[model samples]
Target: MENILHSPINNNTLSDFISAKDYTVSGNEFSIKIDEQTGLLITTPRPKAEDLGKYYESDDYISHTDGNKSLFEKIYNWIRNYSLKKKLALVESKHPKGALLDIGCGTGAFLSVCKQAGWKVKGVEPGAKASALAKEKVQESIYPSLFDAELNGQKFDVITMWHVLEHMPDLNATIERLKELLTPTGVLIIAVPNYNSYDALHYGKYWAAYDVPRHLYHFSQQSVKQLFGNHEFELKETKPMIFDSFYVSLLSEQNKCGRKKWFSAFLMGLESNIKAQQTGEYSSLIYILNRK
Candidate 1:
């Protein structure tokens, strides 16, 4: 939902990474290129930010719809509440509970949980349907974008972006905005799928985490650090989202075989975690950061 892609990359900075189909949207194939400098994967021919909305206008876009019509969705809804608690616990462990800002807060479920736990919470969601639903649970203003939030020189103690950064069109600009909104002592928590994880290698292009144009950039632990490191953010710690491996592998199997290879997917998920134990690279990672 950013004004996106005034990339600083040159031809020498890019190399072919992989070719993937937009499984969630257009069904067209897209090339994922690696920025040799940052180790961040960029989608070639990335859709214009203004034209990106239509791609999300699908019933299949799971985040926007809480549809339990399929087994995939049912399992998602079940684990979500538990994951919400776990996410809160992780944040609280690192920072004192106070004002929090959730960027790209889909459905407001996470903020709702935090609000109930006595934290002042606000959300920024560009999706109209999602922002409307989030308003039902979060009492404070739900701004369509950070620019509209109008904090009036106020700053949040903690800010979070759960699997949201990869979708950002203007990465540097977004980071600058975040820095301005955060209190000097505040923390920034970012959760994103790791391209270097074992699951990614196992599934390759079938990796459901590589959700194409929507995920314009794919990150590794190194790439993530480099991004914020360039913007003067300190990397505090990293946590694993263990459930993500199994969930991602589930969809990956379907994409690979055109059917749900439940048993195979389970094996892959298990293998990925086991390997991550040795490599310190999990299927998904939550980076804890603060102003440097």
Candidate 2:
């Protein structure tokens, strides 16, 4: 484990933020710290990259798992289905249909949608079951890791990481590599949860988005801009993933009481979104960037 004293995005001192629990797998508590410079939150004594896989070995980790018997899982699937088209539209609105790369493209659902719209797509998913399922959706090869995805010097016009950036262990190296893989005029879209959001502050340590340990980094708007901007990626736009607030709050409600509370979660989600409209700080934000 690396007991980091400085923020990866900026070499600034870190201060204690809160102690969060791993409600998904273990009840073990983990401490979180914030980058005094960029406001990014990080889990100290972070699990090594090799050992991180074990944390995700659960049926509840929706993105990697296939099980959907539970009602929450069913809602997750429906939201995913509806969001696929919205994702496609967001990509098309950014740039003309060209080569696209979706890191952590679980099950290749978004890629399949892009392919159906006449755009070439490729995916990278490290999970065994999810990668295998992804292969069924898109005929194109699904690489196990971004490092292993050799493209014969090909570059993508658009690259997306939906709710995926926080899990990456090699944050700085990943951004450098993303730059290498993009075309000169390509667009990069990344979506991550905001610790500055209303729900996050309200739930404090119990915020479900802070799925401690597994989510290695917690990004604030300043952190996102500073980290990527340091690598010369210009911020293009910021959009909200409104539905995420509801979903995350639902899980958070369960985390607090160990049982589902749909109504209260919905109210919290709505209140969070409403408050976000005034603050421009959505629970989850999609940041689009380009080389500068």
Candidate 3:
């Protein structure tokens, strides 16, 4: 598997990788060339943590929650949060009242829900402001980084990384660390966008999920399974993050059409979901894994 070669897929820019020093950012500069081999779209020369941190400096780090959102934004967020909570509830149903660890737990939304559900919850968030806000909802202080968590001796019953695995720089190291942190019976949940989804095919480069620089790897079902299997993990089940199609479609439409096309986006999203149901390919998917 280490010898697998990735052929060029596409070149991508950072959407805003400009600086005064370099008036011209080349494809090799701030942009990444996505390469594909065995269904995995790998970003070349994974961006450094320091380089990536600048992009998430603002409140919009965790999707559209910048400031006082508009009525529509508020409504949209409620729907998204409700869907997320439902998914977490499913996790809770399986491992009731167990210790849970959420990596890259942005603002502690899920942690808040898990706490209320009687789960001993802890979170690791890299952002300063978001971690501070998360601390308000969770009694445990969130670690600034995964390494700082010092979870070596601590075992958790459940570990979750929602849309975070793709951003990791070292896939092998991260997976190994996750395995070490989990109890013998612990389950690992990872959610990521699928490059093989219909929406990805429709938007191509403008696909919101490509999210270059920030999202270093684009994973398909096959790729995800292979990666996990290589690290001694087995897939237990997979669930679709249904609402993600609509949200991703809306963002893709904005990127492609250069404006809001809510109606068109909704129609595309519906079509995408329908196709996914028939093919088991979703815009975003939640994968449940356990040590093999």
Give the best candidate by TM-score: 2
Per-model TM values vs. the true structure: 0.94, 0.98, 0.86
Compare candidates 1 and 2 on lDDT and give the better one.
2
Q: Which stretches of candidate 1 lie over 4 Å from their true place?
A: 1-12
Question: How would the candidate models be sorted by lDDT, starting from the highest?
Answer: 2, 1, 3
Best by lDDT: 2
**Candidate 3: where are CA atoms >4 Å away?**
1-37, 62-68
- Cα lDDT tens digits, model 1, 1-292, are 2322323433345778799988876898888888777778888777788888887878876677667788878878889989999999987987888999999898898999999998999999999998888998787778888777476586899999999998888788899899999999999999999988998998899999999878888888888888898889999999899989988898898888888888888888899999999998899999999999
The lDDT values for all models are: 0.86, 0.91, 0.74
Question: Model 1, poorest ten-residue lDDT window?
Answer: 1-10
Ranking by TM-score: 2, 1, 3
| lDDT score for residue 99 of model 1 | 95
The model with the greater TM-score, 1 or 2, is 2
Q: How do the residues 121-213 of candidate 2 rate in per-residue lDDT, one tens digit apiece?
A: 999999989999988878898888888847547799999999899999879999998999999999999999999999998888889999988
Clashes of 2: 0
